[model samples]
Target chain A: MSGDPILSVDRLMMRFGGIVAVNELSFSAERRKITALIGPNGAGKTTVFNCITGFYRPSGGAIRLSHDDGRSIQLERLNDFRISKQAKVARTFQNIRLFPGMTALENLMVAQHNALMRASGLTVLGLLGLPSWREAEKRAIDLARAWLDRVGLLDRADDAAGNLPYGDQRRLEIARAMCTEPALLCLDEPAAGLNARESGGLNELLLSIRNEQGTSILLIEHDMSVVMEISDHVVVMDYGVKIAEGTPQAVRDDPKVIAAYLGADEEEAIAVMESGT
Target chain B: MSATSARPSHAAQPSGSAFIVKKALISALVALVLFSLMIGVRTEAGPQGGLIYWTRFGDLAALVGTVFGGSIIVELLRQWWGPVDKDSIVPKPVQSAISFAGRWLAPALLVFAVLVPVIFYDQRYILDLSILVLTYVMLGWGLNVVVGLAGLLDLGYVAFYAVGAYSYALLATNFGLSFWVCLPLAGILAAFWGVLLGFPVLRLRGDYLAIVTLAFGEIIRLVIINWQSLTGGPNGVSGIPRPTMFGIPLDNSDNGLAARLGIEFSPTHRLVFLFYLILAMALLTNWVTIRLRRLPIGRAWEALREDEVACRALGINTTTTKLTAFATGAMFGGFAGAFFATRQGFISPESFTFQESALVLAIVVLGGMGSQLGVALSALAMIGGFELFRGFDQYRMLVFGIAMVLLMIWRPRGLIGHRAPTVYLERNQSISSDLVKEGHG
Candidate 1:
């Protein structure tokens, strides 16, 4: 909370044709903190994630990332890969997008593609079987193994990513994102389909990611347990407008947040309905 | 077929004896009628005047009987064996055997390829055919990089082939360069073209990408045909120099391999030398591709193939991955093309046609994409099979069609569908093709 915000969004706007998916929303995610962006379906939470990750160009606003290397990057100006590679921001899709044909270990290795490509001299040295390439490859495999161990998928390292169980695939996706060594990890929905046990594991994983790895996290999730449990800051949106933003307890008790979640206060709603009749 | 299989006939009971008999009878009846109409009756003008109907009853009966008898035997065997349950996992012993073969098969094939000309030193035709098959094998491996690993459906791979051939033809003929010098140059020129072609088609995916590439191939061929001054039009460039060993050719002259080695020169020596040259090039292509697959860029190519969006999200540049795949694949195609020009001592647009692209693609698909040994084996089967049909030219296409169909029905994943993981922590297991995407272009 004390560190300058890792991500600062100001007046973000996303328009598709005549409709505004996200409008005039502003928020900040602190360094090494878990920030949750939650709302009902189609509330543009995912849109904000996409815009911040450079998948979609924002209609208006600046997405500024304060990098660990003391460089502040405007992600809106970069392409999707440059955002990840340069700004050091990584993301995962809501629907699991693991490479179906590649084994679990390979998915992680591929995240370190830029580093390894440089080491291999862009295939020239690698093709010659040089020792430099071998060292780079060894380091890549070691990092992949470390992340695999962190996600508790080291035993299934050889199995195809697509073949892993649903929860395991989710964990693998996180492991893959982590392997990129991102300064900020954005997960669309990490616990969307997980059961209680899996979500518990994910909570523990996210906590360690913030505490041990010290990577800032921004997640779009509908799973309340995950949001309430690990999130240091909570930002709620309704119809692309920020309704409340604070600590989890403060946001939980906010009247506007309650109305957004439960759909209008009972007394006000009843009075309006009576007046209409 | 599914409708027929789904039908609940009493004949389809587990015993299936009656089912076999019914299938045989139906097949025989269909064959008998078709053959009778096609071959039984004929009309000829009589020598005296009028036309007379002539019935070749003995020939008709023999043809009908053969069809009936063959179909019945086939049906009986099919019933006895039962329909193959391809969905079931491969048997443990069979799987292990296949893995063993997968490991040793390439080296064995390499050794066999090296020794073939020596064993059949007198038979020039066999050596020629071996070289042809190896050429296709090389071309197939090239296409495998684009279509298999990168999952870019390049239907115009032949354009690079033509580029390579013409590069060598132009360089060797105009600049008086050696085969070895033009060889790498040809590859570079083709890869340059590949990237040029790749740039415009970057945004396209799936069938659209395929169509654009197909158009690109046709364009290259058309350019070669129309640019008469450079390419000699359809007449082709001739007397393209054959590759030499070091600085010497493979003839009986003072500078030839035979003269240098103090041996009597026969035509076999030249043939044998060419075979070894192609063998070395093919092995080099294989070695480079295999080595690249272990590199990060190689993995990125595969990752792009799997899911481009996810690959981009993971920080791997999709454009570069795709371009590298195209350029690498095209470079190999160029090498093969240069070899083709040297081998034939000719260059023509007819040599680089859509059919060449299709044939190379068939080799990759039939071998299973992303599988190196698969491409080699498929090249052998396809090229060797076509050569075997030299006497029965009319039926070659039909046989190829049937073979392709049967192979698809038997193994939809193509032969050797198992993909060995590039980087594995402990067990290096083969991934089943069932889990692979039917890749977008």
Candidate 2:
């Protein structure tokens, strides 16, 4: 991996009234690597994710994404929609925010909206069913089908996204994010409600995405097994502050991380860390 | 064990006979008081030149007796049918047959619409009434793009209708343009207004958006009224040219359509022609909407409707999605407006009022949001039913309100509750509206 960081979040602070949800947080996710932000409940991991994804403007900070093409974007300056469209930053919600009424194929098609819209000549040519627009639609459906196949949901492409089983929906969400062709993918609690097997499936999906597409991923995960197995770098937070940042193994062994997040003293924390996690 | 009371009782559950009878009696008494005032007394000018009331005890007695009888029958039916409704099931084959008809109903209605004016060519009243119904059908379809597809509650849709009407009116009268030339021009002008109105309210949503649109509609109407030098105001612009076949008008001139076609010079020819024109326009609206629904922008519109947040996350620019929906819908409204101008040969601000907006919205809601066939069906039912009940005068609105309430209670999702998913893989499936969530985007 290149030493240059793809995303650099500097002194990020988010406040809701008097309460600081994210306080002067700083972290850098390297190019084409899986980065995990882990913390206890209300440790501001999601708040940080929201800030990065442009769902919420940080009270103070700079979130910069430096492209391989040598162009850099200040994500905080862009609107929520432009963050995804222009910045090439795609994200999934903690609670699975798929378009519930649309079919699974349509959910993926919707992800490719900008590409299809441009091909449609901003809808005029599409209305006339022009050849170029038809070709774009065919290509979009092909891309959607390929993603569906990868996610093992090709058979259920006609089913509504809401009708998909939980595990499949999780996979579909990743596939949807992939359809956007983002340079950086952010996932919030992807394995939050998954069973052991589903969590394993998610780990494989995230790994394959990184291996095949080489897209950098920034994720907030509660499931340590998935995080430990997939994450190249781990950042641990407590009370809106990053307490530990290192490789997964090093961060897992961090005393402050265990004391604050795992609720263990130094001695017991060492024993828990040594349990081959 | 007492926690059962925490959960409210099921209102649909069977009640005690004594309780039911008591409830029915109360309803009967309430009906008695209401009908008493309506039917009990007749007011007339007295010999001394003052109003006097004459009591009609027989009429009051008959009304009270009817109420009691009606209430008892209703109570009995409710008791008997309540459980049956919960338990009833249709035979498999019959259910399939109904589903088959439901699937084909939209095309069937289109066929029926094309055939109606022809079948009633001899009856000018029926043709005229059908024309009116088709006009509302077009308006409802246009509004469906904004309200049904985009989930934008536009209470001032009549503003676009006014813009369309006035565009055709002013153009035809002032510039002496043909109706055909002005039709698309009116649509374009209305779409421009739609964008103009859309820009200021890009950030607003739901009820606030509705209120703003309502204000814009009133502003347009007030402008048309006050700017009499341009629009002719309350007196309206008259002698507007009617849309003709090529250059031949639907008139008794030697070069007119009746003369060219060697048909009788009856006014019914014009009514029939107008009916077909409006029908064709409504179908075009339906076609374009259906085609748009499958396109990228159209899917964006629906995605925005379902979840605006998710739409933004998906990288769909919601501002453009919303504005395009407004412009497209307004264009259709303009087309319908131009047709209206041609059909009436006159235009007035009174024609484009809040009441007109309400009527079109009622058609869309009563039909089923986003369902083309449902809008057409509802327009026919609402507009034709109104014509049927013309003799009732003051009671017409009251009866219409009750019908609407009953319709809502019967089918909350609307006449056609199933939503056809825009894209499908294996087979096209109609989604139950209960499964479709709106305004979450």
Candidate 3:
């Protein structure tokens, strides 16, 4: 992959009137790198993903994606489909957003639908059930199976998405997002409630996505192992403002990062968290 | 692309799973089919293949078998080719024929239905009521859009019905417009009120929307009542021009249809003509409604009903979707209303009330939301069944009330309910969870 950041955010701000959820946060995620945005709780990392994915319009500033094909898209101006189509930005939610009633394979296939443009034709009404929007549904299943296999979830692909175990659901969420073949894949709190084994599975999956697929990753994760072990670049945030950015080792050494975790009210808790960091 | 992925080796296959499985399934399906066939069989031998050839069982089996069989085909496709994965296995043109017949059945069914009265009934009065049942079927199909597919729950549907009747009555009487011209005019004017009613409730949803639409229907009727000079007050504008076939009026004049056609003019022929007219309008309503449901706008509607957030996220403007539902539903209502005016040659505000909306809503709900067949069944139940109870007028409304209550308790989601949605149907690989999984989709 080219050595350019797949996503460039310059002074992004998201506000709900008086409360600024994410403030003037600027960062660049390099190509094919698992970049982590870690912060104490309520650090507005999810907000950043929402802005980039077109779930919410940013109040100010810009988020841009530099595609491998030499096209630069300003995601802030684009609607959700445009963000998904033009920028090729894909994301997972903090809580999984599967079409719960749908089966696991169907969920992934829906994500791959934008790639199905080759199949839209008049004589193909029989394929309305076929969802011929994409030629790669079989390929999509093959891909979904591979991803599920990577996360050890190939067996549960037939189950309703809602019926999957929590860990499998998280992995399935990641798999669903990846089905879009996004240039920049953003994860929202992927490691939140996973057990150690599941978290390890997530870490390896994220790394494989980066290495095997050459996809640039911008992940919002709280688990230290996932963030520090897999991430190439780490950005630390506190209450919506960026406090530190660098290699995991360097950001782990920053004093401001320590102070930010020492935080507004939970200075003692921050001291404890920072001491571990 | 990968057929091997579909059938994995070493999975536990059911024991004795050979031709035994085939025999078992066929026998079960035969049993089920026979069980269904038994319902349509008449023990009383009533009228030798007449209207009494219906059993609640046949209708029930026809509906249930249709649903399960449709899903079975989907399941087979999923098994054979890995997965259907998309919405259509065929193209739009292939479905057009089925959809065309589905839509045009109103006219065909209407023609066949009109023949029923002339053949079975000796009384002309019963023919008039049959005409009325056919009219409501068209009306239910119209209102089904707003309340059924779109999930808007409009209670004031009858207001549009009244508006069309009045528009035709007033325009025909004052402006002297012919039946053919006023027919379309009535629909347009009714649609205008539909839009007017739609605007105020743009932001309202669910029960609030229901209450507002109910009130709006009442408001239209009240306006018709209080607007003395325009709607001819509560006494209603009468002496409306009769709808003639081409230039030939069905009047008993020397220059009327009898003289022109060189056939003996009977009032039954006139009723027959009106029956045909109502049938045409009804067929047009069914045809247009079905086609609309398959369009981009219609798909957007189903999407909106599934999850409003997902729909908006897909960039569907909910406002436009809701308005279109109102406008389309009202357009059909207007068609029915215009026909009503022509049939009666009169109009009144009394016809457009809260009761009318409730009846229309009842039809949509009972017939099954978003299913064309469901709505037709609902209309058939409400109009046809109610007409059947005419000799027991004292207990007609009571029977309707009891039926609705029992129906609500038994099948609260409405008879057929909304479809299981294509996305789920296309991918659900479960062979056993079919029965319990009915309402969740």
Best by DockQ: 1
lDDT of 3 by residue, B1-441 (tens): 465555444123332435344544565577567666665555555556645554576565665566555555644544455422332122356345435655686467656675765675557876787788778888888987777667677888898888888888888899988889988887888788888878878678777887887788888888889999888898998898888888788977888898777887677777878877887788788777665554345544554554454433333456776787888889889888888888887778777778777787788778766667667777877888887788888998898788989897656656654243333323434211111122111
TM-score (chain B only), all candidates = 0.84, 0.87, 0.70
Per-residue accuracy of model 1 over B1-441 as CA lDDT, tens digit each: 666566554245454667656766787688778877677888788998899887887888887678767776877776677655543334578778888998798789878888898798888788899999999989998999999899999999999999999999989998889999999999999999999999999679999999999999999999999999998989989989988887788877887888888988888877787888888888888888888888898888888888999988988888888999999999999999999999899888999889999999999999999999999999999999888877778988888889999998877878977677898989877787877765786
Question: What would the TM-scores of all predictions be?
Answer: 0.90, 0.90, 0.66
DockQ of each: 0.66, 0.53, 0.09
The candidate that achieves the highest TM-score relative to the unseen native structure: 2
TM-score of 1: 0.90
- Interface RMSDs of all predictions? 1.3, 2.3, 7.0
Name the lDDT value of residue B189 in candidate 2: 98
CAPRI tier of model 2 = medium
TM-score of 2: 0.90
Runs with alpha carbons beyond 4 Å of true place in candidate 1: A1-3, A265-277, B1-91, B391-393
Give the whole-model CA lDDT for all candidates, comma-separated: 0.88, 0.87, 0.72
Instruction: Name the candidate, 1 or 3, with the larger DockQ value.
Output: 1
* Candidate 1 vs 2: which has more DockQ: 1
- Judged by DockQ cut-offs, the docking class of candidate 3 is incorrect
**Docking quality (DockQ) of candidate 1:** 0.66
Candidate rank order under lDDT = 1, 2, 3
Candidate 3: where is the Cα deviation over 4 Å? Answer: A1-7, A29-36, A52-92, A96-219, A222-234, A246-277, B1-115, B182-200, B253-260, B390-395, B418-441
RMSDs, each prediction? 4.9, 4.4, 13.7
